[model samples]
Target: MRRDPKSTTVRRTPWPEGAERALGTPLQPSVVYTAADPDALDRIYDDGAPGFTYAREAHPNAEVLAAKIDRLEGAEGGIVLGSGMAAATAVMMGLLKAGDHVIGADQLYGRSLRMLAEDLPRLGIATTLADACDASAIEAAIRSETRLILIEIVSNPTLRVADLERIAALCRERDILLAVDNTFTTPRAIRPFEHGADLVIHSVTKLLAGHSDATLGYVAARDPELRERLRVTAITLGLTASPFDCWLAERGLFTFELRYDRAEENAAALAAHLAGLEGVQVLYPGRSDHPQHDRAAALLGTRFGNMVTFQIEGERDAANALVRAAGQIGFAPTLGDVSTTLSHPATSSHRALTPEARAALGITEGTFRVSVGVEPVETLCAEFEAAIRAAQA
Candidate 1:
């Protein structure tokens, strides 16, 4: 009493004539390798295969995705890591020794700030967090021990766009490496290397993954030496991403343009809408009135990112209520998901920092961060309007 085969779900496709078919199984893609003599294996042992003899060093999935990222970022090479912090850590560890110093933006992702300001110091590496937007501040911060100058394409929380070209020139004059966290402005909107960055990094968990399904990171460099150092360090540290995660991140890459287009649209609209509302302090880089709007527009052009940070009139209680009231929205710290997410930096992403550190970065209690999704702009606006009204009430 077997069920009819026609009743089962099946996808039928026509195969070309003489297409290799025995049991109708698809053939797996093959890789070509050469090991003609015993000397080949010995040479491999001696060379260590460029520091990638283990999957933890370089998985096939990660290589494929890294190649794609290299192309997208316009770099000579790329390496994918388990997380954003891992990527950053690899860069710092590979390029800087105990006596080295790093100059980073005053306003950076909380974890990044911690890594540079607190963690690196423990290892005898010092850091200076200066206003990255000001070329003079960055120039003044450079010291003989300063090996790297790190800046974000767009500042998180503050959403200020840095002048990469100017900074790049400065770093070049001083013979220092310029590493940029291009997480906020993905390559889709801005290519950091073109603007003079020595290395570019991404938290692929965000817009690059678009769906927020994978936690992956990537680092790329145009300079061959820097690329090799980063890759070797990654291999030694064993912080590479898994094949499945790389595959997920690769699939997400296909629709990067489409997802970002829609989300950017929503972000622009929502930014404008929130500006007109009462009892709210909206900070959107896309808006003309924003402090760094011109810089953002110049760097990102017409397509700004899908992140918005605003402060409510009340306190953390009011902010929490607004977040809770927006039950329709995903209330989580993670961003770049297909579904919108809301979070409070003070308590979530930046919570590891002390109160003084958080305040220094302006992660106030009343601040609410939003990652706009592909939901209809009207629906999103309505939800936010209702949430803000609830907060004010």
Candidate 2:
């Protein structure tokens, strides 16, 4: 893959004036670093600067990746964590105290919803679920004790777009922090910070990593104090990402723009094609029929993301048959892979939600979500056409 010019330039650190210099930041897999003197070590330990302590506290590769993410997101600072959930956990633990309340979107990733609804309450942190797409509903859910408003830029599986700017305004007026999960739209499509968000989080296991090989998460903050709080919490909780995974994910970032462009184009085309099919109900932000189409266009510009969801005209069995008939597409639970894949939220990501809850989110048994890849549009459409036909038969 060709290196992005900006990445190539920023990835390399200047070498000491006279010694041999390397073109790029070499992977430093050392679990610990040694300081030149006790005074230097004391300074390092006290400052908690990058690469000055044990791997779990800080590491070179992770710092490099964090810097890259911070630059990309235009954040004051950032940190990398073991997984997306780890990042979320660190944020909650760092920012909220016992008795604090959090307002979250009802259409969140299943695991996130479960954590908010079940786990946080156990720790004395109250949570209220509301429709994040509705700014009025979100405002109504807020209370005097509310400390945070958590939402996704584009909701999981169902592709609902949140009015982030308006929500951010509300949070600001109420003196509450707004944390946005940018996993679906990513920094390439939309930078939540630009729209007044206080913190932006991403699951690097998805588009930032590009490939499906690494598990990593990142959080970028507009405030340095908040970033430090998150970093300290991650260190205390031992939630730092592995050095090797950070390196791999950084490599993935090199090709992210290219991959996202192709996948987005393919997704738009697929959505249009699926909408024309006789027994399909397509849901994509790019389509005029989507309820949030104008909002998405205004917020994301031309990049409408790579996910396309639809429901077949039948019961759960027919949807299952359709997935089985799509011989050319891989059936995977995750998204943001280079190869096109399909996932059933009812069985995979959102299975923990009750039937009524799922129905409220418009996630029916016939609903199927596709993560479009950088494949030839003609080939992908043809294969899908055949699969749909076979399923109908």
Candidate 3:
């Protein structure tokens, strides 16, 4: 449509529909869009029609991103949220009421534990912590009021692997929802639904986005109705994902498998080198010496993922010295970056946990988690060898 120059200060132009299609996904930042007629507008708003009305409720970039993730994870429906915690909040808020109870893996990410232990209680929801790798322990913790069971496929920092299929079966028998955090083991490894998980969650800020540049989270489910419940909660709570972030994440998604393959290889090589180093204990799911190595092998097959955690022979001073000396790797608390990075649990991820609690979880001041990146394996090992020697000295 054309407007008179005297009557309008701006003109809008669109690509000719039949002429050509761009090879790239266009970045859509518009928060509000128009419809052809009142009925069409109503359909967009009320019927969940095939058009975006607002970025907060629905947007092109997020829709495409969500759909792609749903397919990758074998989900009937999916939604993108503001951050990893936002997706976690959506699951808790959307599924439970005041009297309900939730069971979480004792080794969940510190922020997730904080939400379950502290934040959810404020809403009159109660939570129980269980040894996620032990199916019987989780079953014993379940109560009549239990509404959900949350566990990470590969527990953070310590690399414990939960028996997802076993836990999912228990959730089914008890008529409870099973939500598995697949952040560490991305969908390239396993689809939770095939193991009977009701919901699959991800810190898309991690491997899915493949780059540290994008910060977003995702929730997907085999049940579309359950997904709607989550979507509604995200909308009401203003937890919807940012359109620009979604675009960046989608762009990142295109090369995710490629990036992950290289990163995974580097992680394995780095873990081997770390294992050979003196005065360090390496924790990786792929290592047979790990506590849950058998379970990890059965659950994840060969795609054991890219995170590596190690403990220094000494304490806080040793960890600090290594961080200071590890010039080749960035000292970033967060993970899933393209370049290798290191984080101290006592000071960063698990800092919220009491010193005693941290010690109990095996997260001492000497423990460091590495987010292995798609870099040359030799370069990473050499840097780590120097860092360890300097710290020991």
TM-score for predicted model 1 compared with the true structure: 0.88
lDDT of 3: 0.89
Q: Point out where model 2 deviates above 4 Å.
A: 1-18, 47-51
Report, for all candidates in order, the number of backbone clashes. 0, 0, 0
Residue by residue across 42-107, what tens digits does model 1's lDDT show?
Answer: 676576553233466565678778888888888767899998888998899999999999999988
What is the per-residue lDDT of model 2 for residues 274-370, given as tens digits with 9 covering 90 to 100? 8899988899999999999999999999889999998876667777788888978989889999889989898999999888888889998878889
Model 2 score (lDDT): 0.88
Q: Which candidate's lDDT is highest?
A: 3
Order of all candidates by lDDT, from best down to worst?
A: 3, 2, 1
Query: Model 2: how far is 223 from its true place, Å?
Result: 1.4
lDDT of 1: 0.84
* Model 3 per-residue lDDT tens digits across residues 246-351: 9899898899898888989999999999999888899999998889898889988999889999988887788778988997688988888778889887888889
lDDT of each: 0.84, 0.88, 0.89
Task: Point to the candidate with the largest TM-score.
Answer: 3
What is the lDDT, from 0 to 100, of the residue 89 in candidate 1?
A: 88
